[model samples]
Target: MTSFALHLLRHGAPVLPGRLMGHTDGEPTAEGIAACAAQAADLGAAHLVSSDLLRARAAAEAIGTPILDPRWRELDFGAWDGLAPDRVDPDALAGFWADPDANPPPGGERWSELVARVSAALGALAPAPTLAVTHGGAIRAALHLLCGFEQHQLWALDLPYGVLVSLRVWPGARPTAQIMGLYP
Candidate 1:
């Protein structure tokens, strides 16, 4: 099977950090954008894509002209979109952490829904050296689809701002990938 390289880079810190930033459309700090650009500088990506949201788009623009795609956006948090986790009901928060599909944030999407959208995005990629500037949740959703990780394992990824993970993708009707490297 022919394989191509795929890089998934998490967007940098948003101006409004430490909140449920999912689908919030906040901008990244200058330093945050710089950090992301510096990390991707040597990646030699032939194609670049980003979430249309400002936080990820800013970092993608710092690197190169990117194809802005809303499919790469973060999981929609809905009622909890911009609130601190503590502000949400503790039980509800715990339930979401434990089983996102079973207990998504009110008015938001299920984990399976995120996986489906991300799978579509992954399937649409052209076989090339590609980089996608996206959010932690989007990256995690991709991991779940590509790596077959359980929800419990996905939470442990610890993908911080500006982190990038490389994968070797054998794309086809059933695309699969081996995680090549993870750069913090």
Candidate 2:
């Protein structure tokens, strides 16, 4: 079966560090751009893609000219976008976390929705080595979809800013992934 290598690089730290930044555009700090660029330098993927969001785009652009795709954007936090965790309604936040599918943030995209969108985007790409600069949420969704990981298990990934996870995707009746490396 034909396969593709995907280097999923999480965007660098945003100007606002400790907020629910989903769908909220934030600029990458200079240091953040430098870190992500350095991490991306040796990846050597033939193609580069990025979320249309500012932070991810900045990092992606630093490494190479990237095809900006909205489908690669972070999970939409809706009313909670850009708000600090402590500021959101506790019960609502907990409920959303407990069952992301059953309870999306008030107007936010559901977990399943995010997974589907990202899957569709990935599936549409040509099978080849590619780098996608994206958000942590999008990366988590890709991991969940390709690795059969239970949603809650994803939280333990602990992927920080500028991390790169290399994956091989076997496209078929069910697309699958094998982790190649996790680069710091």
- Per-prediction TM-score, please? 0.98, 0.97
In model 1, what is the error at residue 162, expressed in angstroms?
A: 0.6
Q: Which ten residues in a row have the lowest lDDT in candidate 1?
A: 143-152
How well is each residue in 1-184 modelled by candidate 1, as lDDT tens digits?
6899999999989888889998888979998999999889998889999999999999999999999998998999989999999899999999999999999999998888888889888988889999999999999988888878887899998999989999998888878889999999
Highest TM-score: give the candidate number: 1
State the lDDT at 119 in candidate 1: 89
Off by more than 4 A, model 1: none
| lDDT computed for candidate 2 | 0.91
Candidate 2 regions exceeding 4 Å error are none
Please give the TM-score that candidate 2 achieves against the real structure: 0.97
Give the lDDT of residue 136 in candidate 2: 91
Residue 161 CA error for candidate 1 (Å)?
Answer: 0.5
